[model samples]
Target: MTIRYDLPLWRPPSEGSSLIIQSTIGCSYNHCSFCSMYTNKVFRIRPLEHIFSDIDAGARDWPQAHRVFLADGDAMSLQTESLHRILDYLHARLPRLARVSSYATPDNINRKSVKALASLKARKLSLIYLGIESGHIEILKRIAKGASPRGIARAIQRASEAGFQVSCMVILGLGGREYSERHIAATVELVNAAPPTYLSTLQLDLHRAAAPGFVPRWERHGRPFQSLNDDECLGEMARLVAGVAPARPIIFRSNHASNALSLGGILPRDKEAILRTIAQARNAADSWLRPRSLRGY
Candidate 1:
């Protein structure tokens, strides 16, 4: 008998307690106008046996790792029993395992009962990366997020209540120039609604060919985009930081490479300083230009 793996697993830049497990192949809601990350593939979950074997292999090679991050768009799509089994296996094999993480959609989260999530949390399935994308219902619909602002809020609230640390992600320039202010305001509402322990910001990336649902219709008509300048984008981040009054200690990070200004610090205390740094950086850059990649999408 022979086994082969087709999926690719990527870890974060620096070595951390976490390791990524590519449980699913692509994104279910792959319609975001500005994204091309999973355009080439359809969403699919890996077989449970294969995933278990991979975990076993990693345990053999890197027993020191205590945190696992399920990857490839979203692992929340996995069946409830499957998720439980995976968590059980990880805890059984890696007794040192401190946490398990995954990207989750509101729809996916809503599908599972509160009891299921709490059970997973009890077994150290401790973190969730939710691409809330935008808090605006129109923006979410346009991007095919498949969930409303209310739905997103409910999902996050439930997850947090389940004893898991939630990391909610928002795209900085999601509304371009036209909707930037509304985007920011709605984001504040969204963040305030759930008040997660962590927040990450990513700037909008324009990928014309690969993303149909995400490219604005006006752009298709050859209209010039009114997207944010570096300064305005920074201002959005500043506003969100200032507005979210989470009861828990929140950690904020602008992790995406596309952002002109990278900012990270603990919330409530460092939020003001983080905004000031972004403001300074934006003033220095003056002209916020987009970056280029190897494939040139």
Candidate 2:
């Protein structure tokens, strides 16, 4: 039996090939001003009966599958028991399943206790892809992120303590030109405190859907949003890399398709090199950066 996917499927870049199961529809908090990914749909958790049928279909067709990504924004929003049951069913049916992962919001992570997180981790839900966006409280507020720097750090710390490997992401140009420095400093502080297993950066792209909601907010604040140019964006990236001093080694990447310059290395050890690469990108001709037309969410 062929399983049909819900429209507008999304997964982390690394999970491109993993089987994606939509445990939730849309994003529970779809109000982030910078995000347009889920603006077209309403948020709802998939029924267990439907979810189970999808899993059965996947197991029948892809018995050798090892990685599974629960989808549609934040699947971790599901109740602890519901998530565990899904994980249990996936592992039981696939037999070769090694990990079950999902995109998680800070709110969702905070909703569960460390004990609940530990239980999920024990059941093969080993990783969470968290979009930290920006750590500056003001920037978060401006973007309607509904997350604070301290709250984000504590949530990551709790997940880490629960033995969940976290891959956290920050938007490089989220604060635009005005708030760049504070954004970098606060984000570095947060990362240093929580220290994710993997850290990735994506340059901000103002998709058409997001612009309608985002622009007015900037206008209402009496501070016009000044987007960073290619050079300015690279400069912000350089400062961010240089400022981060994590307690543990973190695999870092700025190689997302949205990024003007591709960069990857372990933190601190490769810090100088990453900075130098950003410098080179800054010095390169305007044509060298990823073309604006080519960039997408």
Give the TM-score of each candidate. Answer: 0.86, 0.95
| Deviating ranges (above 4 Å) for candidate 1 | 1-17, 208-224, 286-297
lDDT of 1 by residue, 19-116 (tens): 66667778877766666767778888888888888788777777777888877677888887888898898877787888888878888888888998
Predicted candidate 2 versus true structure: per-residue lDDT over 1-297, tens digit per residue = 566577999788889879988899999999888787887889998899889999999999899999999998999999999998999899889998999999999999998999999999999899999988888999999888898998898889999999999999999878878888888888988898889999998887675336454563576779877887777778877877888888899999976778887789999899988888777777776756777676765
Clashes of 1: 3
Q: Candidate 2: lDDT of 290? A: 78
Clashing residue pairs in all predictions, respectively, total: 3, 0
Model 1: lDDT equals 0.75
All models, RMSD in angstroms: 3.4, 1.6
| Candidate 2 TM-score to native | 0.95
Candidate 2 CA-lDDT value: 0.87
Please report, in order, the local distance difference test score of every candidate based on alpha carbons: 0.75, 0.87
